[model samples]
Target chain A: MALLEVMNVGIAFGGLQAVSQLDIKLEKGHLYGLIGPNGAGKTTVFNLLTGVYRPTEGDIILDEKNITGKSPAKINQAGIARTFQNIRLFGEMSVLDNVKIGLHNQIKYSAFTGIFRLPGFKEKEQEMDYKALKLLKIFDLDTVAQSPASSLPYGKQRKLEIARALATNPKLLLLDEPAAGMNPSESEELMNTIKFVQKEFDVAILLIEHDMNFVMGICEHIYVLEYGRIIAQGNGESIRNNPRVIAAYLGGD
Target chain B: MNAIKNLKPSTCNNLINYGMVLVFYIVVQILVNAGVLNNSMQGMLVPICTYVVLAVSLNLTVGILGELSLGHAGFMSVGAFSGAIFWMISGSQMSPVVGFTLAIMIGGIFAGIFGALIGIPVLRLRGDYLAIVTLAFGEIIKNLLNAIYVGWDSNGFHFSMKDVSALGLDESGEVIVNGAIGITGMPKASTFTAGTILVIITLFVILNLITSRAGRAIMSIRDNRIAAEATGINITKYKLMAFIISASFAGMAGVLYALNFSTLAAKKFDYNTSILVLVFVVLGGIGNIRGSIIAATVLYVLPELLRELQDYRMLIYAVVLIAMMIFNQSPQVLAWRSNFVSKISRSGIAARFIKQKRQSEEV
Candidate 1:
């Protein structure tokens, strides 16, 4: 069975259909890309899948469990995690703590145990710390684990956010414009990291990116969206050369 | 088990705080027993402890949860009146021990229930709107108390809103509470020791919650609500949890206030009192439990100590507040505090506490 399936998803706000009849599917460990011009409703589809918005009509099934319209937190605990188009780390907290929060669903210590300084509180906390450190290490962020998240450089902030998302132990990961402001070299580095994460974590990826090179370089399958509809979708080579995709990006007078 | 062996700063921090409270309690009690403290100084002890509980709990709402609550005093009044009624009803047959203990329990529970009730609706609104709604609730509660009347005797229990005459109690009936006048001639059952114990419990609960997974979720919400929600943390549940816990502690403070004094009036807990508690949380450095405790105790005592300087008292108080604001927000001071904290965690009591715990586990 496929790991995730989105069937006939549709949504509208004030008579304007933001997305309609969107269908997608993913097998385990697959790398997929969603690309579009500005305001192409790519993010709207992501918001619907992550439960930030309820589809006006559709079903979102993960591992055969219909997860449409659930709370964002519930959708996350169901083994999907995402990074924002704009990085949203908890600025005042340490880098380690930002990652640790992603592992919130995995901790088991009760209020009683926490209050009484019971053995379980200690063990669970220490284990989480170790796990958080390991995640930081993967992104070369272990050295600055004690620094506040906002203190990190912009590129590092993006990497830290991705690391934090991975700490959620997701079966499916979503990246929203992961290479938004990076130069060519930095975008190249991010592409490598994306591929590494898909391979090492064995997690299916659905990333929204405007950067064609970044998306085409790493994605096995690509879906193109424009004006709340899927204009075209195919393997990277086919979507890149598709006339409709080119026309949407390079608009006519 | 291994987490305990690591002896995280929170565990050691609680221990250090407990010691401070315990030592302070003993020293003050000893001073009173030895007559080293004058009558006025003695009178201030219970209030100090009560305000400590109030400030620390308020910190949970204002500091940690990052929500403003202007009806904390309303919850306190709920606890104060309920607790006072219990103490009065049981005064005849029961010992003061049972009366006061039951009073605290009933008071805390009622305050907590009201906290949840009010929070469910009010929490839906954020920032200034919440503050306005809670402020309105506080005023409403104060006015409600002014209209309530309660009495009891062999005939039955009586309660009325309009007037005492409407209660229709016979000559044998005893009036426990009368409209506006409130409870008077109540037994002074709130002791310094009881207040001290309450403070300890408040610290334990607050400290424990802050270190636990639940606390992390709450703080995460405060730091970034949308991000926290995206991380799968239930925003409403944790926000309500913090609010209710904070309210109940304020309720416990109200119980202490009622028992420590001879008369109980809802008017004592109004907008001013709520603001006073907020100031304690703020001056102490929001979300810092130890800072809140010290700030509350010292700030409460300042007015009494300035009694001799009556004419210039308010002036000095203003000056002190301004100084505190500067000291609290100064960049140099904040940098110094963070450095001090890291040092303390590395080689201070935290290190020693961890070592001791490990040694005990091995033995």
Candidate 2:
């Protein structure tokens, strides 16, 4: 069975259909890519999958459980985490504290315990600190951990977003335009980091990237979307040669 | 082992903080009782203690947790009335210590329930709309209390404050709340020690809350709600928790205020008090507990100190606030001040003495 199955999902806002009749299945441990031209409903699919917007039709099943219409927090708690297309770090907070928020759901303490500094509260807090630090170290952010998140360079900020999402211990990770505004060298490095995360962390990844070369290099499978519909799906070579994908890219169909 | 080493300083800091609080409380008690301070000074000190608690606790909702709640006075009123009523019914029979404890707890409970009720619906709204709604709720509660009659007596229609001294006694004779005139002839219950101890406890709770994981979570939400939500932090749950906690603290402050005054006036907890508390949070650095305490004390005392200035008191206040705004807003001014301070410190004879001492010790 697929790890995440979307069977005929549809969503509409008012009179306009943002997404219509979309079906996609992601198997466990695979790096998948979703790519399309501008205004192709690529982000709408990500939103629908991550529970940012409830699909008007069809089912979203993770593993074997139907997870349609769940709140974003619940969906994230159920082991799915996603990054925004735009960088959305807690800009005012220290870099380490930014990742610490992802560890909140796993921390075991009530507000009373926190308020009073109950014995167990200290222990759990130390554990969360250690975990947040470990994640920061993995992303090479440990040196800048004390700096405010807004002070970080653009590339580091993007990496920090991924580290924060991973801190949630997600089963599936989604990257929305992870390489939207990176130099060619930075994009190359990010592609390797994405592969490394999938391999080392053993988490499934689904990325939406407008960078064709980056996506084609890292993704094991690719799905092409156009105007709220999937025009093609296959391995990298197959997708690269598909006539419909080529026509869609050439603005012919 | 590494974690243990890193954790040592924080633990030591916690112990030191508690010790300091105890020492401070003892010193304040001694000063108040030794005839070194007058009754008017004590009166001013009592509200400072309560407002310190109120301002720091309210920061949990307003500054750190990022919710705009203007209904803090509503919770204070609830606590004040509930505490007053509790004391009126049971105070004379019980020891003052027990009566005070029970009254404060009763007040906190009623205020907490009301806080949760108001938070549930209003927390759904964001920013200025939430502020306006809570402000309206506070006024509505105040007006409602003013309109209702609690009982009927020889003096005609009895309200909350009427006959307060006569209702608590047994079949012999007693009073609970005086009708409409407000609670009268009640024994003064708040002492310097009680107020100081409560303030210490409040400071302890607020300090711990800000440093803990949950405290950090609330702050993170305040800093960036979208990022916090994306990380699986429940925005609504944390916001409501802040509101309820802040309201409960405000309630506790109300109880202490009532005990200090030995009465409750419907007019005592108006919108002006709420604005005053908000000013305390802002003038103090937002999310800084120590700042809140200092700000509350200074702001509360400043008005009394400036009373001699009479008509110019408000003008002076406006000028000072405008000056603070200007000082805070101008980056160049801040930079110049810092540079000046650094240059003086580095060039002074004190710096040379310290440097020589360090060099001699190393030799």
Winning model by DockQ: 2
DockQ of each: 0.56, 0.63
Model 1 has a DockQ score of: 0.56
| The best candidate in terms of lDDT | 1
* TM-score for each model: 0.93, 0.88
Candidate 2 displacement at residue B298 in angstroms: 0.8
Error at A38, model 2, angstroms = 1.4
Candidate 1, B172-202: lDDT as tens digits: 8988889889999898999899999999999
- Model 1, A1-253: lDDT tens per residue? 8999999999999799999989898989999999989998988888898899999998999989999989999999998898888788888777888888888888767767876778777778888899988878778888888778999999899988898889888999999988888889989988888888899999999999888888889899999998998889889999978999989999853
- Give me the displacement of residue B110 in model 1, in angstroms: 0.7
Off by over 4 Å in 1: A182-189, B1-7, B91-93, B170-172, B340-363
Two-chain complex of model 2, DockQ on C-alpha atoms against the true structure? 0.63
* Per-model CA lDDT versus the true structure: 0.87, 0.80
